[model samples]
Target: MMGSVAQLWRHPIKSHGREALEAVTLSVGQCMPLDRHWAVTHEASRFDGTGWVSCQNFMIGARTPGLAGLWARVDEEARRVTLTHRDLGELTFAPDDPAEAARFLDWIAPLCPENRARPSAVVSVQGRGMTDSDFPSISVMNLSSHRAVAQKLGRDIEPERWRGNIWLDGLGPWEEFEWIGKTIRIGSASLHVRKRITRCLHTAANPITGKRDTATLDALEVGWGHCDFGVYCEVIDGGDIRLGDKSEVL
Candidate 1:
């Protein structure tokens, strides 16, 4: 066993908020259920929600760091999400409803910078999640790697800053990078590690404060000569993955 699953997270709305899960059912050729199921497009975005589009087309944390502070709870059956933030309190709404979408835009307006493009609409494509990778992918992170970064920075770093889907413990620092081009089994699911997930400005923001408090990118570069924190994997076999499940290279 390479490690055990330590944490699982999902962003119901792309770059908007994060939700914690104890277990999730993975499906072949698909992202985690309801992960990035909806994205808020900006005024300058050309995405009409017809299909998968690049992350740059949406209002994201890299643009507005305050968005990092939002916490989310999802109701998969109702297709509804309740987002909470220190500043905004809470909002419960269905992303697919036009009225709720409009309300969400209003609720989130304070978090967005006035200088940047404002969020225009909430959009989603049928059967597709808005992952950063072109292909549907799940982000896997190593707890040891996270600690390495924190040690370099001389501060405790929150894993949420990376916005990873699954986090594993018991791996060596930077060991996950070697998993590329390999298949890994977590619980009953098998996933093919495709590529390293390069770091972005979004990771510099503190998930609790929603403010830039650390030079995460600089630390990664200065220490390791690269600014990558995790690996992107595509599910090859579908099954249930839960916290504490054994993870191993296949």
Candidate 2:
């Protein structure tokens, strides 16, 4: 039973940072602005036709814990994106500006040692690296499921570990499971509740400081039998979703 949306978050750069918004309007055939639109990649790796590899396979949950702390704010009018961090000052760039990508490469290259030399890299199936998953640009999850998993683990699991594009509140733990294969209306956006999200080692990694926290996994194994935590969904009717949007199950 979907109840109400509790929170909405977006990560502009994959594995680097997240931007929490009070509300956002989405159009078809496009992802939320700055949501995984860019990523740093290595030519030596695959996920390209070269082979099966991805950013999550490397430093994502492994080396840089601070990567989780990156924050972004979008300037919708200016068509610009600003990334900020505690150690790094605010960097503002237009999403489509060629110079912006160059600046991004320069700014972030040294922050993580892996991209130090070849930091200007791009991941284009036609050009550099790979794009994000599926035609469904947005990802949604149920909060009740989160709490259920937390209870099962006997400890609190931070929402960041799931990295969902949206977090819905006011649901019972595992109540979302009932909505599977159903359409749900969240604010102005309608989504088809799809499947349960399975856990990866990334769940064991803290999204805040980026350190690997095995407690979530340990709890899951001892209790839930697996690290499964939340539900995954696709946006059907795109529109604005906010912190307190009604997430009614249909």
lDDT of 1 at 214: 92
lDDT agreement of model 1 with the native: 0.94
Candidate 1 residue 148 Cα shift, in angstroms, is 0.3
lDDT of each: 0.94, 0.64
Q: Show pairs that collide, candidate 1.
A: none
Best by TM-score: 1
- Candidate 2, residues 28-83, lDDT tens digits: the string is 54566556655556434444534325555333534554566567777768867787
Off by over 4 Å in 1: none
In model 1, state the lDDT of residue 172.
Answer: 94
In model 1, how large is the Cα lDDT of residue 64? 94
